[model samples]
Target: MTLNHFDDQFEDSPQAHDAERAEDLFVLLSCYLDGEVTPEERKQAERLLACDSEARQIYQQLSCISSGVQLMPVAENPVSAEETTAKVFARMRQQRQRRLAWGGTAIAAMFVAAVSGLSPHLGPNNQQFAHTPAPVSEDIGNLAPSETEPRSEQPLNREDITSRALFIE
Candidate 1:
């Protein structure tokens, strides 16, 4: 229906401010035509159709359209309900399988990293770098006080340790 015609039709009704009621009447009419309206809505629709010529015309038009749609032929290749359900379930199954595959790949990658010593910790309190041997030079080894000598109270020189570390010797 044209907007102009609909506006004119709405304007002709004395209860123009009651747009909500008009919408309810249209819903009632639709439900009635489909034989699905409650008794109260059916009574209201019938009363409106009897009193208002415009409402009666709209109801007639809707009824005619509903009948026309119902009379149309079915599609040439209609899929049955069971086939549609099967396709939907199959799609869901494929999605679940793909998700499982991705999860398994992530788990395998973490396991490989841990086994190859690339991970930060192999086990609790077991760091990868903790067991690595520090490089030592023969010069520093010789300068260390002999364990066989008498013990002394003096501390070792800090300068020598700093220079040895900085120069990698």
Candidate 2:
């Protein structure tokens, strides 16, 4: 109850020193109960429990406390195991759907942004963009053989190709 009450346990001994020894003995007894002591330490604990009635009483009290803890009521879950599993799976599916939707939207946004950003640069000043290639037709036989030397540095226009290409029959 008080320091003086514990102090009266040992005659002519300092209270702090005796208190520390009592705590050490109690911890040793607890470790022995939990089967955590080494073989040498176990022998020491067994000797202490055999010789001291106080150590034996403390060990018995600790055993009762431990067994009482095991007997305490366990909290019950409100949901059934099946319902919990179904809810977890449903959440995973929802998250997957959201990710897929976000990924597809991000790809489409990037494509639109890229096309819009480059459109202004694709004018007559940009020679690569200015020259529009002739559209391919499924009727391959109606196509004309390329007349200009493919290696020629000269630029040809639609006017230049009038003699060879897509003549109205």
Candidate 3:
């Protein structure tokens, strides 16, 4: 069947949006095998594997790769968690330093502008802020009920509310 037919089936189902999300996560089945997937992603992958033959085949392929990796001998130079964290922090520090270097130039430029009296209010071309007026339309003007219309001054009772109830309407 075409995607349109599948879409029609989804439109008929209450869980249509959920099914679409699950289908989107089908590619993440490999991530599920790696323990890198979120709980929602795992659920979607499982649902897809249970129903889709193509997904099942891809899952089997990914499982084989995982099993193959497990069969290999442990690495002699296995990096510790602390070492990984340190390297990540080092990289972050380098990025922060680069950002600060660029930010310093901007700060210097702003200081020069302030010292040279080129600030917004001090500039010769400075203009007062203006408020734009809202557009006037007949539709908007007619929306409010006129004082000429007769309005019921009576307070609504339980019977009136029950007779013309919220959801019943």
* TM-score leader: 1
Please tell me which model should have the higher TM-score, number 1 or number 3. 1
lDDT of 2: 0.81
lDDT of 1 at 167: 38
- Highest lDDT model number: 2
Worst 10 residues of 3 by lDDT: 160-169
Give the candidates in order of lDDT, highest first. Answer: 2, 1, 3
lDDT of each residue in 1-169, candidate 3, tens digit only:
9999987987888688656655655559878878888998889878988998878877888789889989999989999999999999999999999999999999999898886676665776766664443444658777788999899898978765554443410
The TM-scores, one per candidate, come to: 0.43, 0.38, 0.30
Any runs in candidate 1 off by more than 4 Å, and if so which?
Answer: 1-28, 35-51, 71-73, 118-169
Give candidate 1's error at residue 147 in angstroms. Answer: 56
RMSD of 3: 35.0
lDDT of 1 by residue, 59-168 (tens): 99898999899999989999999999999999999999999999999999988877767534454555343232445666866777798988888888987566555331
lDDT head-to-head 1 vs 3, winner: 1
> Number of clashes in every candidate structure?
0, 0, 0
Tell me which of candidates 2 and 3 scores higher on lDDT.
2
Model 3 ranges off by over 4 Å: 1-26, 75-169
Cα lDDT tens digits for candidate 2, 27-118: 99899889999999899999988899878888899999989999999778678899999999999999999999999999999998878767
